[model samples]
Target: MGQREIRACWFGAGVLVGAMAASLCAMRAMARARADVSADLSPEVSPEVSPAALPVEDAARAPSAAPESGADMFEYRGFVVHLFWQALAPARYKAWCDIWEAGAVVQEAGGPPATYPTAAEARMAGGAWARHWIQNNG
Candidate 1:
């Protein structure tokens, strides 16, 4: 190509690269800001509150004391799907339904825990279950 055409191509490529870089920087800034806001909103736990200091019953009841084999539970609309260990084949994680009243369990559903392979999958199912429960039981 001629010098003028080569310059034009380079200018176009430079503009495209610049635009992409700008967009990426903007996305990162937005993500950082969102993380900061979330950190500010969440209550910070004091380091002094060690698990060993709590009673056995209280430790068992604590959400953070969930078994290492189990994933974290998901909550929605005052309902929670607690994660539990499942030895069953084809499922890695299981969830039990519980009603949360004023941040404490008010009711526990009778039935087997729902099983899923991943925590994210279980969370999605938990959200659906919460929605269904709200519609029918609310």
Candidate 2:
């Protein structure tokens, strides 16, 4: 191949590598943020929580916290999605929140409000939802 062709090929390769690196970095950041949510969910789902705050007894329950104030809050800071079994009598549900930084929670409560499912499931769903927000927004 000629020198010109070789240089062009090298340039293209560089661009591809740069893009891949950026994507990997973003993925790492997102993973870290999701991890924060998981960590925060731990204390929020304990059995000794206030009954007034939780309002539910089953591990499958979801949170009843209201939505975030700003649209940007949901887009940037993340959100809380209440996953209920049914509309009227949601016995057990899951609460999913998305945090921004590695340990930054998007909720006013500093974590997801309250979840009804086992701590594992609540954390899983919350992390999944947070990752979804990051992926979709970016």
Candidate 3:
């Protein structure tokens, strides 16, 4: 091909490389957040940063104070489901979606707020946060 075509090919390659790098960086950050959330699962852990207790969107923007209902807790990839707490008063609490490749939570929604036993499990349940439960106590 001509020099112009060669230059265009290089430019396209550069863009692809850049996108891949960005994706990787995002995945690493998600993994870190997941780790941080798991590591500090103590009474001292601040409620402000906890995923389970996320505050509703700005009140000024909304008309009512009522909590959102039937909202999915998490969403990642194409999976979506509700999470329920089988052993507690508020059986259904929050939801979360797993960005499986990123090793982190892609999204999360309302629930009673409990640290997940495993990151993998939590991620898998993304888009199904309202159905969270202690699958195994071990």
Candidate 4:
């Protein structure tokens, strides 16, 4: 095989490995989350946390999706950053981010060519990418 072909083979293999690793991590995280949720909702729950004792806001508020593992909101200095994955063909994902300052989106970063095998991997890498951008540009 020529040099370019060999390089492409290695790159493809690396992507596969990365995706598999991310899938395993995501599965583990999901399992742990399910266990925790089940424990909280168990029939033997404590009195203070019973369903009837839960509080609701007097005013309606817009609902927001809970951040996934590895994509939770993080802050540095005065900026807030959150990572996400952009789906690409053939089950690949690209890392992306929304960076906020003063309660508004200040930047959006990353995407294309499906650099990651899973959303978890994308988010993890995206977080680093965002931090790097913040360090140099923010």
Which residue pairs does candidate 4 place in steric collision? Answer: none
Candidate 4 regions exceeding 4 Å error are 1-71, 109-114
Residue 64 error, candidate 1, Å: 21
lDDT of 1 by residue, 1-138 (tens): 899999878877875885596567546645654554345332333334555676675443333322213323566666564433322343355544555545444445422346777544655565566556655665
Candidate achieving higher TM-score, 3 or 4: 4
The sequence of per-residue lDDT tens digits that candidate 2 reaches over residues 1-138 is 999999888877875885596567546645654554345454557535533666455333332232211111233343333221111122344444434443233332223455544434454455555556556653
Candidate 3 versus truth, CA RMSD in Å, comes to 15.8
TM-score-wise, the better of 2 and 3 is 3
Scored against the true structure, residue 45 in model 3 reaches a CA lDDT of 44
Give lDDT per model, in order.
Answer: 0.50, 0.44, 0.39, 0.61
User: Candidate 1, after superposition: displacement of residue 42 in Å?
Assistant: 39
Ranking by TM-score: 4, 3, 1, 2
* True-structure RMSD for candidate 2: 15.7
Best by the lDDT measure: 4
Residue 125 shift from truth in candidate 4, angstroms:
1.0
lDDT of 1 at 73: 55
Count steric clashes of candidate 3.
30
Model 1 worst lDDT window (10 residues): 62-71
- What global local distance difference test value does model 2 have? 0.44
Q: Model 3 off-target regions past 4 Å?
A: 43-138
